[model samples]
Target: MRTTLDFTPLFRSSIGFDRMLNALEAASRVETIDNWPQYDIAKFGEDDYRITMAVAGFSQNELTITQEQNMLMVSGQKAGEDEGQYLHRGIAERVFRRRFELADHVKVVGASLVDGLLTIDLKRELPEEMKPRRIEIATGEKLPRAGTKQIETGKQAA
Candidate 1:
C-alpha cells in the first residue's frame, strides 16, 4: 500500500526547498524496495561518513561509483564466470544499483573493497564563505560625546 503526498502547498511557500520536498514525495511513493546488496551508513566524525555494502563476489573492476550534484550512485555488475555443474546455488550473482542523496556540501572522498565489503567514504566540506566566522570587536575606540563642541577664540568685531 503506497500513498502519494501532495507537496504543492510546500512548493508554493518555499523558495529553495524544492529538492528537499521532491525527495520527500519520491520516498513516500516508493513501491518497489530492493534489498539486494545490503548496505549500512555510519557517521564517524562531525563531517565524516561511510557507507558499507555487502558485495560477496564482485570485484573492483566490475563495480562503479558515480557522484553527481547532490547525488551518489553505486552500481555493480558481475563478470561472466564459468560454472561447471551446480546442483544448488545460494549465492546471488546479479547486477545491482544503489543511489544515495547527498547533502549540499557532501563529497565522496574515497572507496575501498575488502573482505567482500565495499566501503565508501564521504566528507561534508562546507565552503569558506559558508563556514562560521568570528566578528572582531574593535577596542580602544571611544564614541564622541554629543553636545560637546570647542568654542573658537577669535576676535569678533562689534
Candidate 2:
C-alpha cells in the first residue's frame, strides 16, 4: 500500500515556508548537471562529508573552488601555451565545471591537491539545540515525540 504524506499542517504552522517550497520547486527543475573530473562523496560521520574529484592534468594553480549561496562549485582551466607545435595532440586540456550541493549547517573545511586528485572536505556541525538528546524516561510517564505516533494497541497507558 502506498501512503501520501500530508505536509499541509506543517505548511500552515510554519512562518516562512512559501519561499522554501518555491526554492525546492526550483531545485527540482534542475535536470541537467555538469559532470566532469569523476568525483566521489564519502560520509565520515553523522554530519561529515568529503568530496574528492579525480582532477588529473590540472595543476593547483588552475583549480578553483568557490561557494555561492548553498552550492559548492569547482572549476579548472589550464593556461594555453604559445610555443607548442602539436603534430599529434591527444591529451585534453579543456575546462570543466562541477557542482556539489551542501546541506544545512554544512560548511566547507577547505581543499587540498595531492598526487593528481583534488579533495574538498565538508563538515556539518549541528547546534546543541538541533542534535538529538537522550532523555531519561520516568517510571510511569509517557513521552511525546514529533513525527511519531504512540499507539496503544493492547497495552494499558499508565
Candidate 3:
C-alpha cells in the first residue's frame, strides 16, 4: 500500500525550504509500478559522485540528459520497435524518464555509456564566496581604538 504525506504543517512553520518540501512531496507521489531501467548513485569522494543506469537495449542517441537550475533529468525512448517477435522478452525497452534533484554548487561533469551501463559523473564546485572561510579576530591591543581616551576642551585661552 502507498501512503501520502501532507506538508501543510511544515509549510506553515518553515521558511526558504519550499523546494526541499516540494521534492519530498514529489517523491511520495512517485508510482512504484513505474520503476524500470534501474539506476544507482554512488559517492566516491567528498565532492565527487556518480550515477549509473542500466540501459541494455538503448543506444547513445536514444538517451538525453538535461540540467535546469538544480534539477537533472535523464530520459530515453526507443527509436523503433523490434523487427522480429521475441520468444521471451526479458529486457525492458519502454520509454522512461528519471529526475534527480541536485544541491547548489553541484555540477554534472561527464557521462559515458559502456557495457550497457550509463555512467554520469558529478562534482561539487563551490564558488569562492560560498566556500568556507576563516574570519580574523582582532586582539584587544592590536585593535585600533576610535577617538581619544578622554575628551578635552576644544582650545585653550592665549
Candidate 4:
C-alpha cells in the first residue's frame, strides 16, 4: 500500500525550503521503483562522501555518470555478449539507472570502477562568502567626521 502525504500546510509556512520539500516528495515516490544493483553511501570526513554501487559484468565504457543541477545520475547498460549456450542463467544482466540528490555545494570529485564496484567521490566546497566569518565590533564611541570642526560644549560663542 502506498500513502501520499500532503505538504500544502508545511509549504505555506516555510520559506526558501522548496528544494527540500521537493526532494522529500521525490523520495516518497521512489518506493515503487526497482532496487537492482545495490549501492551504499558512506561519509569519510566532514565534507567528503563516497557512493559505491555493485555493477558486476558492467564495463566502464557501458556506464555513464552525469550531474545536472543538484541531481547525480549513474546509469549502466551491459553490452550483449555471446556465451555460446546456457542451460540456466541466474545472474542479472539488465540496465539500471540510479539517481542521487546532492545538497547545495556538494560536488562530484571523481569516480572509479574496480572489482565490479563503482565508487563515486563527492566533496562539499562552500564558497568563501558562505563560509563562516568574523565581524569586527566597534568598541568605543563613534568618531567625528574628518575635516569637521568640533564645537566646544562648555562655552558657546555669540
**TM-scores vs. true structure, each candidate:** 0.84, 0.63, 0.78, 0.83
Candidate 2, residues 1-158, lDDT tens digits: the string is 53444556767888877656645655656366656678999999777888999888889999999997678999999976647788987666689988776766788988999988899999997899999999976887666666866775997778
Order the candidates by TM-score, highest first.
1, 4, 3, 2
- lDDT of each structure? 0.93, 0.80, 0.92, 0.91
What local lDDT score does residue 73 receive in model 3, on the 0 to 100 scale?
A: 95
Q: What alpha-carbon RMSD in Å does predicted model 2 have with respect to the real structure?
A: 11.9
In candidate 1, which residue pairs clash? Answer: none
By TM-score, how accurate is candidate 4?
0.83
Candidate 1, residues 35-147: lDDT per residue as tens digits? 88899999998999999999998999999999999999999998897667888888887899999999899999999999999999999999999999999887899866688
Give the range of the ten consecutive residues with the poorest summed lDDT in model 2.
1-10
Clashes (candidate 1): 0
Compare candidates 2 and 4 on TM-score and give the better one: 4
lDDT tens string, model 4, 1-158? 77888788889999999999988887777366678899999999899999999998898999999999899999998777866798987777788889999999999999999999999999999999999999988788796668967876988677
Leading candidate by TM-score: 1
Strongest candidate by lDDT: 1
Which residues of candidate 1, in runs, are more than 4 Å off? 139-158
Worst 10 residues of 1 by lDDT: 143-152
lDDT of 1: 0.93
Better of 2 and 3 by lDDT: 3
> Clashes in model 3: which pairs?
none
Better of 3 and 4 by lDDT: 3
Model 2, residue 93: displacement in angstroms? 1.9
